[model samples]
Target chain A: MHAIVCIKQVPESPSVGIDPKTNTLIRQGIPSIINPFDLYAIEEALLLKDKSGGKVTVVTMGPPQAVDALKEALAMGCDEAIFLCDKGFAGSDTWATSYALAKAIQSKAADYDVIFCGKQAIDGDTAQVGPGVARRLGIPQLTYVCKVREVDLEAKKIVVERLLEAGKEVVESRLPALVTVVKDINKPRFRTLIGIRKASQAQIPMLKPSDIGCEEEHTGLAGSPTEVVKIFTPEPRKGGQVIEGEPEEACETLVQKLMDAKIL
Target chain B: MAAAGTAAVRAVAVRAAGPRSRLKQRTKRYRLPNLRLDEENCTGCGACVDTCPFGALVLEGAVVRILDSCTDCGACVGSCPSEALILERPKAAGPAVDLSAYKDVWIVVEYDRKGVSHVALELLGKGRELADRLGCRLAALVLGESVSHLTDELFAHGADLAYVVEHAALKKYRTDPYVETAAQLIRKHKPEVVLLGATTTGRDFAGALAAEIDTGLTADCTGLEIDAASRNLVQTRPAFGGNIMAQIVCKRHRPQMSTVRPKVMELPKRRDGHKGQVVKEEVALDDEKFLTKVLEFVKEEGSTVNLADANVIVSGGRGLQDPANFKVIEELAKVLGGAVGASRAAVDAGWIAYPHQVGQTGKTVRPKLYIACGISGAIQHLAGMQTSDIIVAVNKDPDAPIFKVATFGVVADLFQAVPLLTEKLRKRLGK
Candidate 1:
């Protein structure tokens, strides 16, 4: 009945900048927030915890500063928090990332029955980590999950509604399964005064690579197969011509422009 | 197999030199590693085995094992439990540039009874750019019966050469014949970059062709560029509900392929007097290969707007209040002869369907004119339609983010302004 939610802290891009020369995001002095989608996963896990009368554990892998994200999750009703931070885990792509995370989850697999993750991380957007973690864990993985239709704790079966291109599919999978939730899953709950106080006093468990039994060579940049040879912001969209006039004249001018552009 | 043998021969010759030329020889031997499985850490979970496209993984004696036939695409590595699987770069691998055999840029010209899709022309434009950059010819592979008449049009639209694969079996898009014919054509005239439209048929056909040829194929690309150093086709696409954009490169594959979304690129201007060399190629086909017979094409009936090709779009948001209120925006769109769009908020509220939604989680639109009615543009919403040629904002909130991007901003209630504007446009149009 216990649920574990994995969260990530990504750059708050509105106030962030990417170093042009290094092809890396400038993180210093930039505000970092819980990945927006992860909020939904945390909310879903909290909801399950509330219904099942069990604890919810929030987990994250990042630098020491990522404790802020775990604290935020704890404030939002998570019973416990875990931070898998090690210098060796830096610069991990989705492949290496899922590896380290899966190992961390496996290290504590006996304590949790269900694992939840956001559909994808905003920073990476690979959407591969959840599936990757599921693959590594050998669990039934449901992705792009919009709704949890039913959960039978006794039977250890969960029915989830996955969002597909045409319609929703109700998939029934056994417990100890992984579900990657989409943004539409649930609205995250706000922290109460007591919850915030509890979070402030909460002692989050910190784990290193050795603690999780993750090989040093396979948990970070060294383990990553693919490398971003270069990263460049796309050219800014050029301003287009403004056909300023009365509505009628503007419409006429637009039609003419479209015709001239051979778009019609 | 022949290509692999030729590559092996070249690799052997390059390696035959002594240790004094080790650095030079090392620059040519790029050996790709197989998927690695760490047995001690494996949880005996069969996830990777089920997920692997190729049967490259097997659960053997409490651990997952990698087969020798692994292509190293790293599909299974993501699914391994205990983080047991890894796709690592082989050490001291040299620069892997083996794309010299492919010399031209080819675009698959997708056409139907309604003439060619605009994406074909858009690819022609992109193809022209890439060809010019590479100093290679831009060609079109027009596959259909009686498509010979389209060759001149292809040339006029930027194609320097047109290879016609004419056959009745290749008339309508089905996977088998189209892929076989396209594969044959590619095998004969290897293209450095093959561009396809991210349409239903184009995706189906292109995926099959890429699988047949055993090459990398990036889908739904919004941007394409040539890496100056590697001369590699960098295919960029919005991933994870447009949260981040990914640029993918087919580093060690020939005929680097990508499918671009329709309307994302500009169509080349057609010149009347332009001419190109047309090479007519015939593909032998039979009914057996094209087994899936078209039962009937039941086309959806409605005032169907080709939103992708729409030059102007009038989009509404949840501020419109009700589903019925969408009619006001629709009326304005009708008068303006523009398609109606909605923000994800409105769409999620069931005020409109997904097709009308204009946002990051929805469709990325680049219309000539985008009219925002009662829409406070969220960053996700702006990501979709911010590339419009001219944006006009009509919102009650004066500080709505849409106003910042709007060429014309009016601080007024959209309910009042939309009806008045629609009436004015109706009168002007004599409707």
Candidate 2:
């Protein structure tokens, strides 16, 4: 089984602090790490490789600095890492990004059986790229997967449980499919000492638009259909009165307040 | 039959061709910003350079040079006093098909065995507004096995027309058949805008459909409106963990697509017997072509109300200290007839199941009231529930950020306060 996992590097922000004058995030000092959700994807891929006896390749598309993310994934036991970086790929939206990623997979690892991706990137939280890549590749998309029930490589079949709005649904799809997993899927493991040494000295290749057969018009902001016309910060919710007193007094006062506000 | 339904709603004057045609005309996938520099009228004063947020412009030799970072956002276009800067788009071949041929605003009405989802109805309310502003019709696209009967409800909820496609292949929300059926109808009967609920099924369906039709789609929009000047759908959504909001536009796409989160919009009042046109259409779908199958649906045990649809929620976090302590939270929720929620920390610690988690990764809920007990309000957790109508925080630490957004805060131990509060509420409501 050859499993390919797609990952992204996102700004590590517990909560963003706003620049009052600029009305934008103070992004200068923040460091970049692998998107938290993608860790699960990497772990799942490694687990699949561990069980099935094959290789796990991690792929990411970003600026040059994104290679650090691929290195981290390598340290987490992925066999290979590919970094897709080019001037043409800057300012790409989810549509263009997914298209570029799909093109890279086709150019580099077309023989793979399964592709894994985090349900969504934390910064964008769009969750569209997984299905978008599936569409471009003409494969089945199983999103929000919480469990991998079975992987019958002989039958070229895989069954998984995906979380929906109301409940979890067990879905079975053919091999060569794409899956976006949620945190409930599995716990991501830490980097091992041997894996870190190998990753530090690993030769990760960086692919450009030409290397992956991506057109300049289809891989950047110019190729994107949607554009952010404007950006602004939402008004913060105001903190209300804090009734600090005895537990009995606070409880009675809160219930009285709810009753007065017609919330109780 | 498809063309007949299409022709009935063809009421608008088409303008230029859809943006997809122009997209095909581009030779270079990536190019530097095509800014026309009027150097003859240039003062080289550097006002445009200062206005560029990306620092993509640098005043080189008393002339502004556009850098590779220029995103063509057109932010500096209007800052030049001498009108020396103009963001230029490529002059492509004429559009193959008229973009104006797409006339109506459509809400892809999602229904299950339980009937229409609330998010679908919420979309109708917003879709009606968008259609009204655009001076076009509001239509509902219902695709299901036996969803023909839903047209009345669609019309009652402000849809001016109903496009119903009935087939056993669409019995459940499978991506292949649903995308094929919806794509066929959309190609035949063009719509200027398509709205969908950002539910799991809707997100899955819309992403594939957008990629299939080669259009743009904005996900989990909190605001939707029509730009009066350009008649484009303006979609506003929260990004960066809800730290900021962005307004997006699909000016080139024929049908601008957007998926809105549930409970973000107001539900429209339903009018019984509200009359509208019902356009029934059919498409051929072969079950053999589908590559996926649904084996079973397992609802999480002990969750009577889905967190998204619940009116009240009582969420606990690591402050509970133990998994068994969730019983206190659960007991309070039971007394209040509310659902249980947990912070990421608690859920990560295996104190509770993932379904009951409430935060960025868990769920975004807007219940009538939210009670946060023993939870240190992480930004992610706050992002999910800050929109709830009322928040009451009970914590030992007064400085926990959760108190900042809570309508009422009690700085006390939850073990002491929660049971007392539950008892008081139970006696007051006679539960």
The residue ranges of model 2 lying beyond 4 angstroms of the native Cα positions read A18-25, B1-97
Per residue, candidate 2 scores C-alpha lDDT tens digits across B262-373 of 8889999989989999999989999898899999998877664478778889989989999999889988898878899999999989888887888777777888899999
Model 1 CA RMSD to the hidden true structure, in angstroms: 16.2
In order, what lDDT does every prediction score? 0.67, 0.80
TM-scores for chain B, listed for all candidates: 0.72, 0.81
Docking class of 2: acceptable
Query: Fraction of reference contacts reproduced per prediction?
Result: 0.01, 0.47
**What is the CA-based DockQ of model 1?**
0.03
The 10 consecutive residues of candidate 1 chain B with the worst lDDT sum are B1-10
Error of 2 at A90 (Å): 1.1
lDDT of model 2, residue B316: 93
Model 2 alpha-carbon miss at residue A98, Å: 1.4
Q: Which candidate has the highest DockQ of all?
A: 2
Q: How many Å off is the CA of B265 in candidate 2?
A: 1.0
